[model samples]
Target chain A: MDIKPIFKTLIRNPVGLVLIATQVALTLAIIVNSLFIINQRLDNISVKSGIDEDNTLMISFSSLSDSYNMENAIANDLAFLKSLPGVNSAMATNSLPLSNSGWSSGVSSQSDYKGVEIGSAFYFADETLVDTLGVDLIAGRSFRSEEISYYYLSDELEPPVCIVSADLALTLFPDLNNPEEVVGKKIWYGGVENPKFAEVIGVINDIKAPWRGWSEPIFNRVIYVPHKPIFGKFSRYVVRAENGQLDNLVKNIQTELSNFDDQRVIRPPRPFSDIREVFVRNDKGMATTLTIVIVLLLLINALGIIGLVSFWVTQRTKQIGTRRALGATKFDILTYFLTENLIITCIGVIIGSILAMALNNWLVTAFSLSKLPMSYLLGSALLLILMGMIAVCAPAMRAMNVQPAVATRSV
Target chain B: MLKMNGLSKVYRTHLVETHALREFSITVDEGEFVAVTGPSGSGKTTFLNIAGLLEEHTEGSYQLDGIELTGLSDRKRSALRNEKLGFIFQGFNLIPDLNLFDNVDVPLRYRGFSAKERKQRIETSLEQVGLASRMKHFPSELSGGQQQRVAIARALAGEPKLLLADEPTGNLDSNMARGVMELLESINANGTTIIMVTHDPELAARTRRNVHVIDGQVTDLRTVFNNDNVERTAETA
Candidate 1:
């Protein structure tokens, strides 16, 4: 195929060239945005969940009686489940990290500190909670076995006690040089009505409750309260298995509890990682929808290319006939238009590549996505080139099929 | 040289059948300028189309430059047409997008001439048509006579064995038509076999031989040659 004439022809007809550019630009824009979204979801998935996923079994059960024996049922269930073979330890908590929906309250450093409201997810746990949930302690210490519930007092005259995450510590007192030192300070909550002030007892790393929901930067913002004083019955108990035999432990625990209450149901056991996945399910769905949209956009671009090429072949029928009469083989005619479409496609691909990069930046800013990686740009460019080939094939065949005699007559 | 034996073309439609040509036959020897004259809608154009390999005849035996035209593939037909024949249309059908020089150069490029060779051939052909200086001008920029000259130049550049001109001066005034006819005569005199289809009996009479056709059959054949001794006196008078 001679490319020189095809390029000359394309340069002469700016309208056809512009049509190709439009298709390429649209294709690249959608592809870049879709890739950016997928990358962001993947980044979210790889962030550490801050829990020992394998050795943990999260079992949620709700009370189903008119007069629920909240404290007795929970205590009895925990004791019974923990005594089962293969069970390392068990803790009853109102919510788990990365679980959807829970309570939040304003946390402040001093009793009278006037500041913007800071939201933190609340967790209620016994002393064994630290070992059972597998959260890290970045500073200070976990609540002692006997001292977990007595650290904070309801009266204003008594010394305040509570633990805030490193993130909350920073937000409450931005000038504080050390998060560990912030632990011993007094903070107040339950503004106006209860107005209780508490001393910081131990600061552990932040945790997410799927229900309460963390704002951005989850680790920097949760508040931990010991399981005593003001409390409600927890709906769930998580058992940590020492041997990672979660199935064995669930079987033994369910058997031990079968005689306690026939009406009480043990929900299926799931690893903590599987439980956390439910919190980010929306992100996965968004990524899948974006992929489908990009695929549809690519198909639209392919159709547009085919339409434009068909128009070109129709318009150039006489010229093709003339060329054949002048000594162009059928192969020559086919090659002429193939080279023409390819030339147009190459230009569009080059322009589309540039547009893809610019569109990636816009997507990142608009969607809070991580930076668009180079691989996505390169991959999309290649896909568009292949799309051009597929789009041109039908038109090329039509051009080649034109008879030389068509030029002899008016058309 | 060209030969046609039992040439036939049939057009089929859903409700009708039309025979454009039937059992048509003709032979032109080397260096002969044959004029094919017929009224509008006659089979002159069909014969030209078949002879030039532009359209296929339904049943025919055609030999042009010693190669059988029937049973040949479209590609081979295109090659034969490009290499062995030249075409001149009534409308001076030059590609509007290309300049005079490039229009002539178009066929040469298909012949795979190098860039240097294509340029040389284009200049020489344009010079032959007395439009060498206007080689860069487009066909629309020229007069009817000049445009036809360019078309002739386009055909001549290929150096074909046979030249086919359909209504060579059909669209021009008397003066411009005379000029185009003279150029074609000069080209034929250079030993290229020319078969021209013209509606003008006067123009057809000027050729060495005239074959007249009515409907789809040849009606008469005539040849005119005036001695130079009597022609000189007629010019002087």
Candidate 2:
């Protein structure tokens, strides 16, 4: 059980020990970093978008003819969609959550204030927008039916009323304890010098906008203006279905839209969940690739330990026999080998902990990744130690089975 | 302290069964030094292996210090070996990586001796072999005689009731062989039973008793040599 002897033995075979230790260290570093990144990506993809992802479908279209009347076309499509049998609510908006594109603007508490502005994604929709998106209205009331207006791009007019997300409201009125207190507050949008102010009619629960990055702190900040029948060459429709009717709605949406305006080209209609999947597809791919790399790294490290231990067993056959003849039992021999490997693995783990932190620091600086937690480093060390033991088992058993009579044989 | 009755060892194969030892029997009293002499391939090593508890006999009733060895589990057997027996090999099988102190410490470690006790025993055993000052030196740093001494120290550190030596001086020069033999004599004088296998006639003659074996059977050297001398005297008359 004296590790001093084991250390001396390892010192004698520096090359093999160093090689195995280096392999273990590298494996720990790579696996820890990969797992951290994978965990981060998983967390990013799991962020709640505050939409009824399963029940809502987003359908987009662009006007193919220059003479297409955007306002009338959108109104007809909305009415037809609303009349569908399973459709619970339908509203046209500039963008859909998890569709990967939206509009952003800077907002301020005071129209004349010239300071850092809070940035938020913009959503322009009608009174039915809350119902279609399934967003919870935590305070105040949604826009009135009469407050909705069909605004054109050439009209050069902004909606007088807007709903702000709870997060955005908190940014505007940080000292306010209640969201109801933020209801009558006014926020100025556009540039401070030429600001346009709108009353905060309602405070909705958190919702993520499509264009925001998962790492951004303001991902949930959004403002909704009461604009109906969005006037543009392209328009997005958010349609909500009754329970269990999402698939049916997605299937029949293109036909429904085309029946309203045959001159327009309709893109495919997809469930919000599918759009979210497409949006974070790269993140999922990254997680999968990192998982594979971690698995391969562990396997290679195990093989390296096995190979080095096997070679040591072969090289020390006579020594093992001598120990056996000198009253060392099979278990003693086995423990000696296992303990030796543990020492080597411990060395690697120490070096690997440092390397893992360094790599995480680099990631944090280079890609804005969160710092690696100490718990993960400790977990990785324990894992590698276990791997070292498992990898050394066979070779140690071989050493144990060496006959004491082997010492009596010459050479 | 050691006894074997009707011991038989058979080496089996698909084509042939080699009888390494047939109906072999031997006994050594407590505190006695006995030497076993045999030619190459004469089953001496087989007997030594079985006697050391390193290999199982095909059929035998063997007892060491009044404990039945047959049919014992490997754990029991190993425990018994660690508690009661020690071994020295001709090749001076000292682990090259370990220093002389640790080489002596190996058997004591297996015997479950406390670290302090192990250190004391290792130091005393090395000192007995006149290598106490060289305890820090590795086996590779020592001469042939010194390495063999370290092996002897390793065997002695357990304070075993029985010490088995297999050609303990085979790989040494005559001077070194003599030195190892003197060390063995001193150890035997300390009342520990000793069984040595040797091909050297001089070494065999030095022991308290010598047993010669050939063709898997023990031969009575006294009867055979006396009979030959009588025949030569009659031919001369």
Candidate 3:
């Protein structure tokens, strides 16, 4: 296909050329960035949290009667859950992973560390909490029955011994090469004046905090204290069920646990999958919204190309018939329009690439987004070119039908 | 050389079938310049279109340089048009975006000539029309006479065996038409067969032969057709 003459023609009448090209450029910029953002949100939604998400269930309930025995009631619940056919392990705890609910505290390696140096989430549960959550404890000894105790927040008392995530262990003792070596190290939590120290009895493989990105310093840093909260009226517990029975187990557990005592009022047990959905709901919504935006932009760009090229075909009927008389085949007519549209698309993509990078830079400065990759630019450019070709096909076919006799007739 | 025997063209719709040309038989030998003159809706342009292979004849036989043109594929017709025939239209049909040189090069490109050959032919053709100095000027920048000359140059650039002109000077003033007529005569003097459709009787009188048409059929012939110069069928025309 010869492009020089077509370029000359477009240069002479650049209105349609400029309009479609500008639309293509703007569409490329916005769609490329929006695609990247959608991909990021999808990635966040799919990231792995350090727990058996599909098999775990968390349930919270508050007793309405004053006669409710927190200690005896929790024991009865654990015994009944552990004896169920599909149950793996059960424990009462203050939190679950990826639930968007959390308790945090400050920890440090130095006694003189002034402010909150290393922040970490705190999970309070009994000796079976790690096993119930199905997290791998790489270097740890299970807490003995005597060591586990009930904790009340009003006392402001700190646990003497705790298990730490490998990440938090590394941060507390940076010089240690192996995370297991820091299992017995001294760690301090609480305020500066009355700082309390706990001996790290174990080190577990990282537990993800309730957050979006795991790369943040505090998201993977956690301290698990072996204590079930003894708040007088309300309590929360987590249970792990066998793989295929999680939803059924949750349904039965709520009804069964409500029969434990007359004062007991059981809330519905929630699968951890639901908790995960709650955490990433906004990200999912954003990804869906941006996907719609990308689709709309593409449709608009394609229709713009079709509208402009169709108008050109209608305007140049005489010109096409003249070309046909001058020995151009129908195939030649189609090729001419395809090549012309390709040239216009190339110009738009080149400018759009530059605009994409500029928009990405602003995104980085304004919204803390990462840089746009080159693959997306190349891929989207090729996509737009393909779209332009498909969009121009109908008009080109219409141009091809113009009879050679039109050039001779007085019109 | 060109031949047409009882050629007919029909334009059909569901309700009406229009016969544009009927029993239009004519034969022009090598090196003969013929003028086709008729009134409006007399099928002069239709005859030129069929002879140029721009439109197909619905009936009868047509040949160019002894090769039968019926039942040939579109590709073959296009190739034949590119290699054997050239056209000049009334509108001066010079692609408005292209300059004179590029306009002349259009047909040569379809002929599959290389860049150097096309450039050389375009320069020579434009030079023949006395517009080589204005090769870079677009048609809009030229006068009606000059644009018609460029169209003639485009037709001549392919060095086609037969040149077809459909009212080539219809849009020009008298002076411009006279100048274009002189250029066509000089081109015919160089041994290129020319068939021109004209509305003016003075231009028709200038040609070596004249064929007149009315109501989709040829009605008069002013040339002496010796067997050595023309081969024709015994038909109504």
Docking class of 1: acceptable
TM-score of model 2 (CA atoms) = 0.94
Candidate 1 — which residues are off by over 4 angstroms? Answer: A42-75, A82-90, A93-97, A100-231, A239-278, A364-368, B226-237
List the candidates' TM-scores in order: 0.74, 0.94, 0.94
lDDT against the true structure, each candidate: 0.75, 0.84, 0.86
Ranking by TM-score: 2, 3, 1
For all candidates, state DockQ relative to the true structure. Answer: 0.39, 0.66, 0.71
Ranking by DockQ: 3, 2, 1
The candidate with the higher lDDT, 1 or 2, is 2
lDDT of 1 by residue, B34-53 (tens): 89988877888888888889
Q: Which of the numbered candidates is closest to the native, going by highest lDDT?
A: 3
Error in Å for residue A369 of model 3: 1.2
Interface RMSD for each of the candidates? 1.8, 1.4, 1.0
lDDT of candidate 3 over B1-237, digit per residue (tens): 899999999999999999999988888899888899889999999999899988999999999999999888888888898888889899998888888988998888777899999999999999999999999999999999999999999999999999999888899999999999999999999999999999998898778788888899986556555755753332336
DockQ of 3: 0.71
What is the C-alpha local distance difference test score of candidate 3? Answer: 0.86
Model 1 residue A350 CA deviation in Å: 2.5
True interface contacts reproduced, per candidate: 0.52, 0.77, 0.66
Q: Identify the superior model by lDDT, candidate 1 or candidate 3.
A: 3
